[model samples]
Target: MNEQLIHSKITSMEIDVLRAVKQRTLEKFTEGPSVERARLFFLLLPYFDGKHWSGEIEASAKTVSIVYAALHAHDQVKENASATKKQQLTVLAGDFYSGIYYQMLANLNNITMIQRLATAIIKVSEKKASFHDGLDRTTAELDRSVQQIETELLATFYNFYGFDHYTPLATLMLSYIRYKDELECLQGGSETRIIRSLNETLQHPLHTERWLLEKLDNLHDQISLTINSYNFNYDLKNFMLHQITPHQHRAEQLTREG
Candidate 1:
């Protein structure tokens, strides 16, 4: 697909997903879902590439976005120490979005994808919980968890639809984005679970910063190699490199400045 077609499709999916999860009270109180445009791009990549796509598949893709929105809603809930009105509603917003995903799938009669997504959610939740378990995990071990938290849902969707070739690229790109956000949070002094977990694992904020910078560099390289290995069209590859994954050297410059 050309850049316009790809971008248009992604924007359409974003609009559909946002409309799918809208709620007046939740919108009023809680931070809305953190549906990254990059993530949505990857979710719709198969369709963009003209894979085994159908309306059912496109509808399923929307539900996958809904699932991501559902999970991200819970991530907005503040720590138990501060249960404000927004925080209370944040939890319910997650549940409400989750229910919407289930109902959406049930209406499609897509029992198989529902089961697969449920399994993915379980694994993602387990990895997320490990952050709170007070385990002295090595940086590698912790990163694996973070990678799962970043990629499991998308991986599940890709695998279900025979788009497994995109898994490595997806994992690398998604983790890169997650680390990019974490790096930004560290610089901004924002408190987040990923930041706390990275601090605990790395033993210092500086070390966490260094680790994230290095990881981003490594992921960017891997993403380049993985994308090159695939025979994607010029437009797809260009959009991915220029639009999705950051330039690692530039990212390092910014991180060092911070």
Candidate 2:
């Protein structure tokens, strides 16, 4: 399929997801559940790539997205601070999305998937907690934690549906996207849990920036190599590179600056 058509299909799935979890009070008070487009693209990648897709598989994909939204909502809840009404509503929204995902899987009679997702959620929770647990982790360990946190649920979905081949690409792209966000947060004079941990580990903001730049360059190279390994058509590959992950090498930037 062409890129536009692929994007259109992804947008359709996104709308369906948003409708599935929309709540009046949450819409009014909280930011509501985040249904990210890039994530939706990855969740539906198999379908996009002409894998055997059923309605059941589509439903499972939606539930996976809902799970991510639920976790993202909970992540927005402030720690060690008094809860405001919005904060309370945000918590409720997270719980509400969690229930929606459970009910969705239950309706589909996907008990196996539910069990698998529960394990993935536990792993993701543990990884998130590691950032604040005051335990010293090596950069490799920290990268693994971040990878699990970002892609575990999606990886679960991929594994369940025999699309595990996509896991490596998904992990790299998601991690690159995450580090891109962290780099932006740092440049914007804001701090996040990941940034704080990274700063503590790397020993300075400058080091963190350098690490992020090098990581992005590495991931982009991997993505270029991995994309060629797949049997994707021109439009699909082009869309993934140009739309999902446009990269500019840091070394090239430095050379031009010099």
Candidate 3:
């Protein structure tokens, strides 16, 4: 599909997801479910590449996104701080979204998928907890945790549907997107847990910045090489490269800064 059409489909899917998990109190107080366009694109990548797809698969994908939103809401809860009403509602919103996902899957009679996604959620939660557990993780180990945290649910969805070929690409692209967000946060003088962990590991924000820049460049290179190995159409390739993961080299960035 063309880029515009691809985007249109993602937006439509986002609307469906929002509709699936809409709640009045959550909508009124907390930030509603954040269905990222990039994630939706990756979830629908198999369909966009002309693989077998059905209404059931689409519903399963929506549930995956809902679960992500649920986890994200919990992630927003403050650490070691008294629970404000917003935080309390955020926790409730997470649970509420979790229930919606389970109910959606049950309605579709996708017991296997529900089980698989539950396992994926367990893995994701474990990796997320590692950030607080002070396990003395190396930077590489932490990177792996980040990768699993970002892609495990989608990976489970893909594996359940026999689209394992997209796993590596999704891992690379999602990790790159995540680090890009972290880099932006660093540059903007905002510290996220990921940034704090990296700073602790690398021993300085400067080192963290350098590492993130190199990581993005490396991921972009891998994406370029990996994209060629797949039989993606020109439009799909273009959309992924230019739209979803447009890259600027560190050198280019420096030159622009100069």
Predict model 1's lDDT versus the native: 0.87
- Model 2: which ten-residue window has the lowest total lDDT? 134-143
The alpha-carbon root-mean-square deviation between model 3 and the true structure, to one decimal in Å, is: 0.8
lDDT of every model, 2 decimals: 0.87, 0.93, 0.94
- Per-residue lDDT of model 2, residues 172-223, tens digit only: 9999899889888998999999988998999999999899889899999999
- The per-residue C-alpha lDDT of model 3 at residue 56 equals 93
TM-score of 1: 0.94
Better of 2 and 3 by lDDT: 3
For 156-209, candidate 1 gives per-residue lDDT tens digits of 999988899999889989898888988999989986787888898778999888
* Per-residue C-alpha lDDT of model 3 across residues 1-258, encoded as one tens digit per residue: 898899899999999999998888889999888888989999999999999999999999999999999999999888888988888999999999999999999999999999999999999999999898866778999999999999999999999999999999999999999999999999999998888899999999999999999999999999999999999999999999999999999999989989
RMSD from true fold, candidate 1: 1.9
Write down the TM-score of every candidate. Answer: 0.94, 0.98, 0.98
Which rank order by TM-score, best down to worst? 3, 2, 1
After superposition, the stretches of candidate 1 with alpha carbons farther than 4 Å from their true spots are 250-258
How would the candidate models be sorted by lDDT, starting from the highest?
3, 2, 1
- Tell me, by lDDT, which candidate is best: 3
- Report the number of the highest-TM-score candidate: 3
